[model samples]
Target: MPKTQPTIRDVAAAAGVAVSTVSKYINGTQRFSGSVEAKLKAAIDALGYRSNPLARSMITGKTRTIGLAILDIRNPHFTNIVKGANRVALQHDYTLLLVDTEESQERERPLIEALAQRVDGMIISSRMPDDAVQWLLELSKPVVLFGRSQQFPIASVGTDGHLAASMLARHLLNLGHRRIAYLGFAKSRWNDERRRGIADCLQKAGLQLDVHDAEAPSAIAGERACSAILLGSSQPDAVICYNDLIALGFMKEARELGFRLPQDLSVVGFDNVSYAEYASPALTTVDLQSEKMGELAMTKLIAALNGSHDDEYAMLEPRLVVRESTMRRPDTSQPAGVTEMTPKTAGGRRRTGGQGA
Candidate 1:
């Protein structure tokens, strides 16, 4: 005869609790007192009992799983977002189905189709354009967007990019940096909104925000983009990057090309990623509170799953973090040969002051 699998009922019996109590505990739907919890743990451990998600989900008509689709898991910012989502999902007796889209729009459709079939709902950090609403509307499940917004008015949670861009530009402008450059692609909503903010600040100062092109959001692309611009005569004193990864790349390549950081070229980056602070000169980037945004996004998605939320959007706050990588625009003079700068001030930051609203 086949050996019987240890059931929730068996564990309940061993723990001297009602079957309902065990169910609640396993589902993370209720809390138990210390003594009761301890007894249940011991019973389950001794019996080697495991809750079958499939069996439980079948009875409830809910897979109790959420999908998290990101552009790339290799980026530190996305990793933090995933970490935050996982934290909330675990507390609700749920797990995530992670999808790395590799930043490819061609692969997004297939991945979404597969994920929708298995998950109750999804949270996507989509890199696709806003006009791709038809595909989003066709999904079988609800989706909460992270860091990216679309024209479809789907539920989203992210930083206010316009306000963030204004803050970044204001910092550079206040430090007397003229000919500040922005590095990123503008086809996405995130880029367009930020571009508007950068333009707003620059126009007020009677200066133009130089738009530079990057092959991708990675450091390698940043390096290459900066190199291309260096070949030109008009060089920006400060460059606002799409993210820390790009900023790090541009900085690395700039130093290799014999330019000293902050002394000759000040760099500003978005996303205060983990390695941003530990980079060579430490990155001065925007703190979008990415983890908090992810937590809020997951909470909103879960609430939507429970039919408790409207299809509304939530915008988090943004702020600037000053570090060693940026400073007041210096002499704008090239070093005779590897010249080092001695500045009057160290690192500092300014408050964003208000939201994009």
Candidate 2:
């Protein structure tokens, strides 16, 4: 068996034509006279030739692969999104090259530049800074962002973070809780979206949100932020977290501070990540349709790759998921340590705290 793939030059030589002519013929963007086309076809067949994805990309400037830059692959939240992208990418015979920024734009920049040569397009999770984004845009490659915001102009697929936040706020307020706080991630589009959502929900209910930034969305960050919030002069009747990990961290810290769930405080988280249910009290959260968002993003990207220059953006809706972590305000007369909290609508109606209906 031949060890090495045949090169374009070899094809050109065999066909008795210049390499550029052969490349143009192969890419199908150039018109060739009848005799030249026939000769090239004959040479291709005789060489048992297949286009080298790498070499062809070098000549035609298209890798046919998409680069995916994720903040953290270890987090189930990001992985869930990737699963969706993978499904769609496979359907189009496209490969996804995943790179972790680890929440650092500086580290992410060089990685993106390195991968740029290997991919025709990029789907970014927004670890890049403004300068980097501007640079990427200037590079003139097709880019689709996962998180949406007015600040960025690239086509995007994002969850309805604002609505999700509002829903969570309203859920707690309807449970007869007067004091509620939001523990959210700071300095990101998703963070801002969720915060705006919370504000919207609070406004509709004639309530105000006590928003606190966790500095990080990681479990450790959640723990610290929760501790600080609980230690404050006034403890909130309920807490809403940026994501499930933060919620779980808050719960753990709240327990340490003798703040029992659904009794001393109700808690809700966003993202509804896998670990949300496995936590001690299980987290009440907003399902951001994360996986579905990923799927939709790739679908749009594929359409663009197939030569659609039309502008498209998608915002997946979110819904509240009632689990054990949220419920009606505790009976003041009763001592803490009760389990199982029921969910309430933003309008003060009781509902099951099971899976999302």
Candidate 3:
């Protein structure tokens, strides 16, 4: 007789279970009892049954896959969000496909269109404005946004950028950071809110907020942006970064140029990425619950796919993690700029450098 390949039906029969139960367990779509699980495992081992996801998906009318779009995977914060989303996807026996738009809005539409055809749903860290969200809503697949927008109508999970920055600003104000500078990207989606929060807080304290721009969200960009600020005449007593990656970069450059952490300049940052704790002075940052946000986005997306998604937005509050990076502003005001790094350009500007609804 010819050799026969073991099928899902064969395993089901061996385990005295329904074929659907066997299939569901194999696909990780649902959990099972211990006894049933043991039987299923034994049956699969004995029969050498192999699952064909494609065939199973075809019959069930589900691809069992999700697509995730991020502005830039290079950012450590986004990397942690990916980690969080992946955990939820695995728990549900689904696969995740990740793509980056390189922080370009032009690249987003094409990525979304291409990914829409391959997956049941999507989660995005969208960087565009209202029109973009409207366009995404019209797509075939369900969507969950990872950040905020005044115009977002679709479901989103986000930490309150404005509130988070406000909290940091208040903390700094309490610590007496009058000459504080903001370090961040100019084109970021959350830039307006983040700036508003800090600016408002500063205004309340009768101080003007100094804004410095970074062209990109990378560490190297941070180093370049901070270089000008560190060398400029109007050096701030403290600097608040857009995110931990940029903050870490600024810290590295500052230390290299002989600026003592929290002594010469107090520094604060957003998005408490893993490296924040391990940093030389241990970064003081906002914990945005990045992984939890990712998990929530994925969970909501799955629910939406199953016709159980709520239209309400899920907002997460960021917690401040005070480490060695931030301290009381030094008694001597007008902290000295690092003259040894480089000379500033003739221009007065920096030379080199949220949630869905």
Write down the TM-score of every candidate.
0.83, 0.79, 0.81
Error of 2 at 45 (Å): 13
Q: For model 1, name the residue pairs that clash.
A: none
Please estimate how well model 3 matches the true structure, expressed as its whole-model Cα lDDT. Answer: 0.81
- For residue 84, what is the lDDT in candidate 2? 91
For all candidates, the clash counts are 0, 2, 7
Candidate 2, 28: how far from true, in Å?
7.8
Task: For candidate 1, give the lDDT.
Answer: 0.81
- Better candidate number, 2 or 3, judged by TM-score: 3
| For model 3, the run of ten residues with the poorest summed lDDT | 348-357
The candidate maximizing TM-score is 1
Q: Per-candidate RMSD vs. true structure?
A: 6.1, 6.4, 8.8
| Superposed model 1: Cα runs more than 4 Å off | 1-3, 8-48, 147-150, 330-357
- lDDT per residue for candidate 2 within 212-306, as digits (tens), equals 99877788888888777888877788888888887887888889888878778898888879878777787878777778978988888887787
* CA deviation > 4 Å runs, candidate 3: 1-4, 7-46, 331-357
